[model samples]
Target chain A: MRLILRQRELVADAWRYAGEEAGADAPLIATLAELRTDPERHLARRGALGVRLTPVDRVEELATHLPRLALVACEFPGPGEGRGYSQGRLLRERYGFAGELRAVGAGVKQDLVFHLARCGFDALELAPGEDPAAAVRAWQRYEVGYQPGAAQVVLRRQRFFAATPPA
Target chain B: MYQYDELDQALVDARVAEFRDQTRRHLAGELSEEEFRPLRLRNGLYIQRHAPMLRIAIPYGLLSARQLHTLAAVARRYDRGYGHFTTRQNLQLNWPRLEDVPEILAQLATVQMHSIQTSGNCIRNVTADHLAGVAADEVDDPRPYCEIIRQWSSVHPEFTYLPRKFKIAVTGSPADRAASEVHDVGLHLVRDAQGQLGFTVLVGGGLGRMPIIGQVIREFLPVADLLSYLEAILRIYNRQGRRDNIHRARIKVLVKALGIERFRDLVEAEWQENRPHHVQLPQAEVERVRAFFRPQPYEILADLPAPAGNARLQAWYRYNTHAHKVPGYRAVFVSLKAHGEVPGDMSAEQMDALAEIARRYSFGLVRVTHTQNLLLADVRQRDLEALWRELEALRLATPNIGTLTDMIACPGLDFCSLANAGTLDVARQIQQRFDDLDYLYDLGEIEIKMSGCMNACGHHHVGHIGILGVDKHGEEWYQITLGGSASGVTALGEVIGPSVRKNEVAATIERIVEVYRGVRADGERFLDTVRRLGIKPFKEQAYAPHPAAA
Candidate 1:
């Protein structure tokens, strides 16, 4: 039942990379620095690896960088900080990077999964022994938005004023 | 009274939806407090000292019976069963909860009303003469132009976030009932030498910390260029108006600092650069808006009936009513500034009653005045008695309009979080002391204005006898000023002497009136006498220490 996530995986691999003598089969995860800066270093050489990035770390930077790297991870540093959500949007919309943008750290609340998904975060890392099924159900609460988003049924209004001349 | 076309309606509906979403996000913690603050303020929702206050726009003080009723409903349902009408010709509802604001705005939208641009550092509700259409001296109805400006300024992209709030007042009549000289941008609808209707544009006049009379920047701005010219002035202010200090942020302060000539040059340069791109006003559009406010059908009658035995009605008619342009019709004023009542207050029942009267006697139109009074225009001479009877029953037929008791006061210490002293109580005390209407009519046109602070929200500086409340050593003290006027040839009121304690204000006003009565030389109004004798005579009488009696 002890499934290794991004932050824990990165800490476990860093311990292994430093030649520690603990559990050898414990999965490894890459740090936010691995995703944000010098991604090739972690992508080219790793075992059971995951990447972690804070919301403040520019998401536009990952649009080009995420595709070359095999594994990518994103982190929400604290509650109510939304830079990560926008970073996820750039990753989904512009670059078309489909790899997992994992929601990690204390910022992973069940209520935010829908927003994270809208911003193209498909996978989430919760605290130890937390259920992901309940977290996934939180995204289905609101069915409509006046604004267009990643959710289906993106409504666009086109106004036709009789007085306006054709462009 | 311009009816919203589909475009206008769509715009308002979209804006309401947008604001609702913003409110939802703020409440649900999707938006931070800092991000939500400006959005709510732009929508006219303010977090006041007691509760959330919502200000509804009443563009140029014109409202239909239906609109007024909608306001009443909103007040009764969302607020504390009452609303306060402001000097800017808008209504403010106190005690609306933060969560209920979207619902309130939705209700307002149904009546073609929204609180947009009411509170922000943007172009505010345009005010005009309350008697625009019916006044005898008016050149044309200013409502059409006011409506045009209202649309142009509402949530304007370039000018919505200015250095400070801006106000524009328009006056079609030479009498200047709208107080054009005290607004940020004052437009006087005038006829040039060739008999063309255009605006004599004045800039930088305002009443806040530094009171000033606006200077004429353009002698005669062509009627067609009204919007373009206004855009020019706003652009100049937005780019150059001081933002570093809040006190010096107003256009009036900037105009003063740069000097009128320099400011005019700057605006003219801006006008030159931006004139070509502005949206031209079409004649059809003007006619379309004007059609909504066409003159009500008035009957031709020879004369007004002689004063009857109902002395109360006669007193009310003489003091509260004004001459109408139509031969037989009269412009009747309903005094909301009666003693002990808050200024510009009407209960839901009272609102319905007034609506009934407007439908019955005055072509279904009502006007809220800058002086916190209401008007029923185009009332026939024969229907005066019936109208008076109905109004009297509603407790609105107060005979003290433009008298000492009909005081133009702000929501002082009671409601306004910024006020330093209690103005409503002072107004009540003065009204109780000067209860005799016959004596008041004899006193003749004494305008008493009270503001709780130096910000001049009550426009105390323009009153005939101005009362400014100051917090002196943890107690309320009032300063008196004489000879200020907002009408035809505007002038700021002069302070007679030092500030007096709040308790002694009634005595001071009485003494000042006595001085005027004693010095008058046949057929002179209070303002005229004060103008003739200067402030010296009134000062000596007001400040003279009571003689020690033997």
Candidate 2:
């Protein structure tokens, strides 16, 4: 059995990925195409609704299904493709999707795990040949960041340059 | 020169430790070469043709005397005895062992320097006018804004992987010394009619396989809105830029394809979505960084007596000095393009000497210009002669700045793996042909730039007389371009005609200059002459049967 990482810990992912091993009671992960075509069918039968977001899919497409999506997973199409990071941010921040936001795709390397975590991915499906233990270790690479992300603090607003803003 | 506090220091130290472990894993075979490529590149380690090259950032071209000494030490301890100052105002150690890079980075951290974001498909070092604080033009200094941008862009998670590298250049003065208009984002710090600070932003300007002049995206953006607006631009580019072809990946192609109006609309929409809560600069934050760049404690000297120096000293003073905002001080330029030497290469001994010079003469501050020369930004007028004499002994007093001989060229076939032909030899040949100082001074402010290939690392497209080395079959061929400027009105040069053989490059340039001297109006610069007369005369003179070429 393969293991995935969640917040820098090697653990079993509750949400099944696109082609991963899942039990009969696992939530059916639907792509954006299927969700747009037949939303009711996907919402009708499952342990939980897991909608997958592609690099090119508009994050707004998943907005209407926010209440039903127990897991929203974003896929990286290519190595240099950065749309997934932004896609993850929108699903978590703009739409207020509080479900398990999972990051999947063979293109998500270990070096990008910290960024993926910062961009609001609670769980990451490691790329083929990438060690899950290394992914867990690599997620602690940066302690501070420039921009404010979903799970990270903004260093620009940190108390170094000046006093913090009023609460 | 923004001082780093504990948080900033901690962040850099953490990065150094991370890279060290990454190196250890790669060497131990735990991480594959494919997996380590981007990781090492983000830390400015490049596996070059011969060895690994490490590029260190020189933010806004400002450096302290102590930093200079540390750089000298790094050079002596590592690969070679010298380091190369690149056209982007960054330093490169062309021959570092891959295993020693982490240790090298640790050494750099002690001086508040790092190699972060110098390579890979990330935002590069923020460049500004070398004389940012000292330029005679009256305006706010641009370094503080550059520092803000630097801090905001450092290890930015979202922007780490883009289609291609992004660059930003800032200029405070209207004179446009920093080549702001030829960058990925050109920021002109301007004041409004109401005396409010703002920026005139330009997007999509770059030089590579395709050279372009940036278009104005925002005419006047309030200073506080800068970060949000920049994020919006980067987000749009990251989502929409081409990923299939590397050649068409730069933001310039996307901006051109979308049309400036539509691109502006997209960026505006994104900016609207991210504003009000996104990384906006607060008043206190801006003041914090600005205070570090406030004017140094300068003694008030109303005027200075005439310097008692020889004619040689007078010539050096005339060419190598720029007017300073302070009445009694001047900005002095040290020419790295001395005869028979590389344009931007400085030895360890020379670097140490420069450190000592800056400490004694210029308030212990030095700035590296985009043109690859060094600037002592706070030289007193009364010390000009004495400084010149000392510089003369050091062989740095080359009175050829802005003349025909002070040309900019890239690390062509000699040290670069991507180069198709040689640029240093071409630069040397041209320099030798115009070696006579009298003739070169007569030629006047001519900008000769060269690039080995279309990558345009040398900024050849913006030169008044540009030379491009092309690979014809296996031998090297040369192409000549004319009438380009990177100042207020940025433009790419036009090719004159057929490409010449390598041996004919010097003769071709000589003929072109002769024609300019012949038909030029009195006191006209080479660029002005080319623009006024057009490329017709140059093409005719260059291609006409030349006995000298034969």
Candidate 3:
């Protein structure tokens, strides 16, 4: 699933909800900052406020808190900051966060989708107007893995090596 | 040495195939020279002043007899009959043709070796103490960890294009034989409060241009986090290190620009973000690598009786060899740096002979020292005379082990493209000038290093009387520095004065010694004399405008 919107537009829209009284029928979408500090406050008001977590200030810190949340948006601050990649890995492998894991950022190019997915981020909120089909094709570009990562390569190598025993 | 397993073997083979393809494409004009430079350098091929020099990684200077023979075979076939062992424990063959390097690399791959990451702006060969596993004072063997790093740093995607070459040296002993303080990153293994082994990681220590001792960035890094922490450091350096100027490209310069505390904080921030979820070094994997270097079974025997009527063997024992950690064993140094000879140059035949002696008498292991000497680590005491006889026949038995004649001179202008004067010729002249072995033995452990230029490639600044060549009016002039030493305690040599004309260099050195000998304060060495009464006296005596007029 893809949500094509500029990160600044999303962030600025999220800020507009700051200190406002929410109605009971508000849609189940929340700003990113509310997920960081006072996660418990948002948790208490979850159903009524229709709140969802954003990039949890720190990945490892949120690993324990992630199981309770149904939706979390993993924000990439820039093109190169890779903290969210590790965050996605921990959410999937350690905490077993089964709900939506969305990636949001500028230059969220199609090539990075495979890595994000491997790290357990299933939804991508790319820069405005990026085609989802083009992003999906990027995931299938590289079939081989030279390094052991959270990607499909490790699993494939394990199966291949297990099937072939040394003489 | 860690023998390559199937995984390592497969990776190297694949890498060779990849490089061969790259070379083919370049030759076919598909890849431009600018595009292909980094690719060739990553594979350890460099187009130097005259030819393509290949620096092969000799991880930690530990090689089995078979590996040495393989190197010898490679040298004889692909290169000139010799290879120069560098101070960083890597071997460089000066005469390998550009086209033949891939085949030479294929030969190295057969022996579980390759030239990957030996040059260019990436991590160079990770050096460690030559006496690592065998040293008496070692906390633990550092080679296994070095090998682990060697694997991690080889062709690392992120670090392939670093601003400058990176060198990391690990030393398990407190003696610092590896010169850990003078490396890009120095890892000294030490026991912590709980008796667990960890590293005191020093960063930014280097010698060239701005020689600053590395500062301790991490007081104690757990052994398990070694790789991840190194990744953190390299990542930070690769991203933030200065690339605007080649002179300021080393990580040392970065650490200098940002104070040590600030640099440490930056590395810690990177580490906090990128700490691997699973520790890279599981105990089992560490053990698997360590098993390859398990100690050989040593014989337990009494000391040998004095040799029958052979004063030469006795003299060699007295001056040339060191005691081994094992009883009835000794570490024998074969001085290839003997005055006038190029440091660490062994003819193919001499190498073959040494290989034979190693297999026969020394548990099939040979070690190359940073001081440009070869060591037979496990020589049995009883076989000392026989070993000496064989070495003597091959001209490898030079009795001046650490004396004046045992000089460490680089291939100055003779072979090195960077040199200004003829270092080998000057070395030969000094050797011929002082041919008396007895006089050399009496001089007692003087390190005279000669570099062809001020680049300090010969480590001349650390020698007792360092000679640096300068180009004066298109003619070579020699500058003398005194009191430089690398072992036990390290000091940079002090310069004497105005440079001497090339023809007057030998006579000037003789005069410096005459002043040293005339001082006559019983048992004071040349360095001690220079240290006591500054270079002022030596400068006045040696640097007269015209010695003939004087």
Candidate 4:
């Protein structure tokens, strides 16, 4: 029954996170601790399995289990806490995580939408009181950036041509 | 100087539009103060004591005359009629309103400048040697690399929000004018054994409550791997650094906790594992950026003789001008530390006039030093006299570039909400006490850097004479440190004695100088004397019962 912005579209989330009662038809997103304890047990669940990663959770531990996973949710406790960004990047680029890379927790807001997307978060589950339409509009804040990111095509690639001669 | 391309302009324009929308939302009460604080801070807007302070980035200290004029206009039109040049080679407008910042930023974008990442927990402006291209003892210019780093760090997706604010400095010369060792990351341009250009990378050096010198992480990082190596290091810091406590969150604390060797190993491992995905510096891009820093054309001419002028002019020439690699040119320092005035405050009128003067003499460009002064790096020797006379008329020629009165001070309690004491008045008292130029010349090259708090915004840790302000029971007191030096054996000063009363700070300094004068060896500088004799004599003299007390 929760709503999230997935690939620039606001849609109802069918995945349930930890602490919530697992629905009969909903895919359960378990914590990294749960998945690490008995990977096969979680892997053999009724529906597709997802893993939620805290800031301190190592991405390399989940690499071998990435292919069987349906989603990877990186949690940000607050806005100033930024370890999730590195987690998102490592999951996609280092571990080749092709599943839905989702950003969750209290820190996900409109201000962080562009950065989260740039760091390879294909879906963003913002905190309470955040506007989804404004978060979608945040993607247009920058058409180009200087560094190559997870979705790398938006970077300004051409060599700098000065408008005036150098001194 | 590097000029902005169409792409650069577009990014800046987009940023202005985005900030405008963000500000509108915040004003309409949609965003709470806590939610909007980080967003505004990343754009260099700070809610200071009096008003919002906007810090504009001056990348590698280089500025075109036209850009300077725009800054003057911004100062004149938006806020106060003046701005403060900080120790990081950035300009801060002390009284800008939050509502007006968007419009101010839009105006600044017209001239290819923005205040992006000048504050907050993101990577701040990339700083470098002020005398980048024209210094006599240079390996290579550091500006191009600084620019490359600037672009890579600008709104970096992963590293935008970190444990704490980060600073990086690059220096090319052996003299280390950029103070790279005291930064979060210091990049030194050096040549490998086979004569290939690379960087000697240092990590975790910072000046705050706990000041620590940066440790060398890599002796020689190839030019091609600059961005990748940086990315690896940043990734390690962003992931492993302590975020539980804000005070213990700097990379320095992490480096200290894990030990430099362990930290370096982690960085190296991360770097190796992600080599393919790491951002690599392309040779073509390096060349493209380097082309913008090509040396200005110089005429074939011999060095001229000393100009016949008044004693003030001669003194100005001796103290305020520096040697240039080119024979006929000299790099001139426009002293912002004029006695009895605030250290780095410059009026809009002065900025506009300086822009015109720079256009006439120094190829329409200026450089702001980390010591909070301006420089015309390409002035001809033949033009020194005329330039000095004009500078004298404008009150910019103080003839006290390296003396005791030439201090580095933060805005302190007057403008900073976080300050514990007022530093500008202390600066004025010290200036008034040491009014004699002859006495200042005798005790040559004593750097007095003062900060109103432990934040160390004034870089008091690396000064030869560091003064830190502390509050005790609703009263101001100053703690003095000695023997710190930023260049040629960089060090942090040691505490000399107990805190002195606010009014007695200058007298305490006078006592320390007297001890130096009594005990110094022949031709030794103040720092040399302190290093040789240690702070024992200075401390004894500083704490001895005063005549008035007796």
TM-score of each: 0.77, 0.96, 0.78, 0.97
True contacts kept of 2: 0.44
Tens-place lDDT per residue, model 3, B105-173, is: 899999888888887788888988877777888899888889888876764434555778899999898
Index of the highest-DockQ prediction: 2
Compared with the true structure, model 1 gives a TM-score of 0.77
Reproduced native contacts, each prediction? 0.00, 0.44, 0.00, 0.57
lDDT (Cα, tens digit) per residue for candidate 2, span B258-369: 9999999999998887643366678788999999999988878665654555766777887888888888888899988888888888888888999999999998988998
Q: What CAPRI class is candidate 1?
A: incorrect
Task: List runs of model 3 lying over 4 Å from the truth.
Answer: A1-167, B276-279, B305-308, B338-340, B519-533
Predicted candidate 4 versus true structure: per-residue lDDT over B20-45, tens digit per residue: 98899899998888888989999999
The DockQ-based CAPRI class assigned to model 4 is: acceptable
Q: Is candidate 2 or candidate 3 better by lDDT?
A: 2
lDDT string, candidate 1, B418-482, tens digits: 87898988887787778776678879888988899988988999999999999988898999999
Q: How close is candidate 3 to the true structure, as a TM-score?
A: 0.78
Which candidate number would show the highest TM-score if scored against the true structure? 4
Clashing pairs in 1: A9-A29, A10-A29, A30-A50, A32-A52
lDDT for residue B322 in candidate 3, whole number 0-100: 81
**Isolated chain A TM-score, each model:** 0.63, 0.83, 0.64, 0.87
* Cα RMSDs, all models: 10.3, 2.4, 8.6, 3.4
Q: After superposition, how far is residue B181 of candidate 4 from its true place, in Å?
A: 0.6
